[model samples]
Target chain A: MVSVQELLKEYIDEGRIKLDPSVNHHTITVHDPCNYVRKSQMAFGDHMGDLNRWITMQCVDPSLYREMCDDPMNNFCCGAGGGAWAMPYDEERLAYGKIKADQIKATGAEIVMAPCHNCRDQIMKGLPKVHDMGNYKETLYLWELVANTLVIEPWSEEEIEKAHAARDAQFERDGIEMEEEEE
Target chain B: MAEEAKPMEIHIDRKNRKIGGIAPELADRCFTCGTCSGGCPATGLVPMEGAEGVTWDARKAIRAIVFGMEQEVVDSKWPWVCTLCGRCEYACPMGIKLMRSFRAARTLRERDKVPGPIHKGTMMNLERGNNLGIPKEDFLYLLADLGKELEEECCPGFYVPVDKEGANLIVTINSKEPFGEPDDMKFWWKIFYAAKEDWTVSSVNWEGVNWGLFSGDDPAWKEQVRRIIENARRLKVKTILYPE
Candidate 1:
């Protein structure tokens, strides 16, 4: 089960996806999701910490990227894992997330790239309300960062026709009917 | 002579000694080094209010379980407070898998007693195939609407294919996106279009977020996983892309 991160990395490496770092000229830091890093290290022996940083670095200017004090495997949880985000223990959840808030504050980055939904919600919604993160600007999903920065080359007429043909063939092979639509 | 202090008579509830059938020996190996608590962000968060000497930490919770006070651990808000992020396990000197015990503690709680919307969400996913109980028709409508918006916004020929057999990939969407941030769904579609990936979204049981994993319902977790797998197999897809 490859992550969008993995796929993005592969695409970027293969020259299929080109990222334009100037899309969002803001200081950014990556928040490592627990499952992706620490737990993954325990279970898979590969922390994927470096991979996350690699992706983040690719999306942002090198000068604008900031590293959190505790990176990856040692990174603090956003305190929303284990169903805490949906749980009734808001008070406790916020208290636990305080550690993450402080970590982000120390980084002094305008944006936090949280790959996990739970972490993104906590950092984006839960943290700033209680913590003093005046410098914090936005939280982005890693894929969102990539999507926003992608340098999409408009498809040529031939490419568009070929893609349409391919799509029609796929539908036909799958025995699915497609409504008439412009390519 | 001062009256002899009566030895603290403790009635051990053997029933609570083991959490969700997790081995007591797992807890028995604790070195009581307190490293887990030191690293644990939830150390003192849930005080089990009004209960004296009831504070939370991985070490203390393990001790409670080891001492047959597992019921107290489960009854309190401590288990819920712990995110089971595995920091305690990572820092454990004895190589104890603390998250297992914590997850087991979550299982010990009654479903209704399970905190917040997690259990309910899991049940909804089990019954209706998605959290938030969004019906299949509404989900499809949302997908089609959002796909059209995405096409107009960026991708020219992008339409989210639903249940397309023989597709290379079956992708699941987090229910939250369709419910609240529908635009977030475009991020993936934009990427898929650029890559020209052959991916199909299952109209039924297509939720990416599995609350069962969080709620400590093993069967529900497995069932949710099974549904995703079944969708992938039904579509004859080689990959099941679940970002959550």
Candidate 2:
């Protein structure tokens, strides 16, 4: 399996992909997938450098990044492995995912980037319940953040003006007064 | 006169007692080594309870099968509980290869006899496109509607290219998302739009989850894999990305 983190790094470092520096600087933490960390050995191996470089390339503060639990080869399962999610032991699986969710919450970062699909699913579903119960914060995928930051073609002045006109027209139709506010 | 009164003696075939044609040489190879049992997560499961039963570990189970003690091995609950994590193979000193032996024994058993709901799910997946037996039209409609909702609600201008031919990447999504949590499908669409990747979701055989792998059904597993490959081929996708 390809390491999404490494792929992200290659995209940025190799100049195949570019992200707006301002958007990329947002603080983030990565939830290492057990399959990627332990099974693929990407966390501990030379692949670690790729992730470090990728994070650095995004201009994220080094102190903001938190280490995963039992990270690298010894990382704990995100509770979705071995078809655990589909089995009769779903409660157990979610309970296990809570550990990872807790780890992400401890980072206090705005965004959590989970590369694995199972980890993403489990975290996205379980974290909100955790948050509702006052346990942990929410998690998002690494790709989501990277995608959000990509340096795509900016909207042209004409397009921006058109969008502004559309918004004003909608507000006018609703009889809502628009006021300019200072930042 | 006493001998004449003796009841007719019947001899049972002790050799036939072997379970699943277990061989004696395979049994002899096991050195009562605890390596297999030590790493096994299912060690203390029923019948193989605690340390006393540790001796009848995976290697022992294979040995009993090999020694024509099929009844003892088959009746043992150890095989059903084992997750086949390959941790035992990693920890074994003698390289006993117990999991393979157990799998062979499992294959020998009838489909109905195979343990767990996962096996049944595999059969369902083989017969239906998904383990849930979701009709193709329903699957497509669910995905299409979810994609539209994502574009309307969470992320506007997002497009989930369904059945787009000759895309750069073909992504296989797990059926769980579309079936259970349709909104979750939005996340991928958002990512794809933001990344500006040439990606398309297939209308047919797009589920990435392989139940056959979990059920130890190779043919079913291959069928699922083949479906994905065929879809990608038909679409002329350069890469088939597995989301899981």
Give Cα distance to truth, residue A37, candidate 2, Å: 5.6
Residue B237 lDDT in model 1?
Answer: 90
Among the numbered candidates, top lDDT falls to: 1
Docking class for candidate 2: incorrect
Report how closely model 1 matches the true complex, as a DockQ value. Answer: 0.55
- Candidate 1 CAPRI category: medium
lDDT of 1: 0.83
In candidate 1, position B217 carries an lDDT of 96
TM-score of chain B of 2: 0.78
Look at candidate 2 and give me any clashing residue pairs.
Answer: B18-B68, B18-B69, B18-B70, B19-B69, B19-B70, B22-B65, B22-B66, B23-B66
Clash totals for all candidate models: 0, 8
Off by over 4 Å in 1: A158-183, B1-5, B11-16
The interface RMSD for candidate 2 is 7.8
Residues A23-46, candidate 2: write the lDDT tens digits: 544456666564554434422444
lDDT of 1 by residue, B4-82 (tens): 8888666656554667256646677888999899988999887765668767778878887777777888898888888
What tens digits encode model 2's per-residue C-alpha lDDT throughout B148-201? 565455444444566667888888877777778676666556555445567777
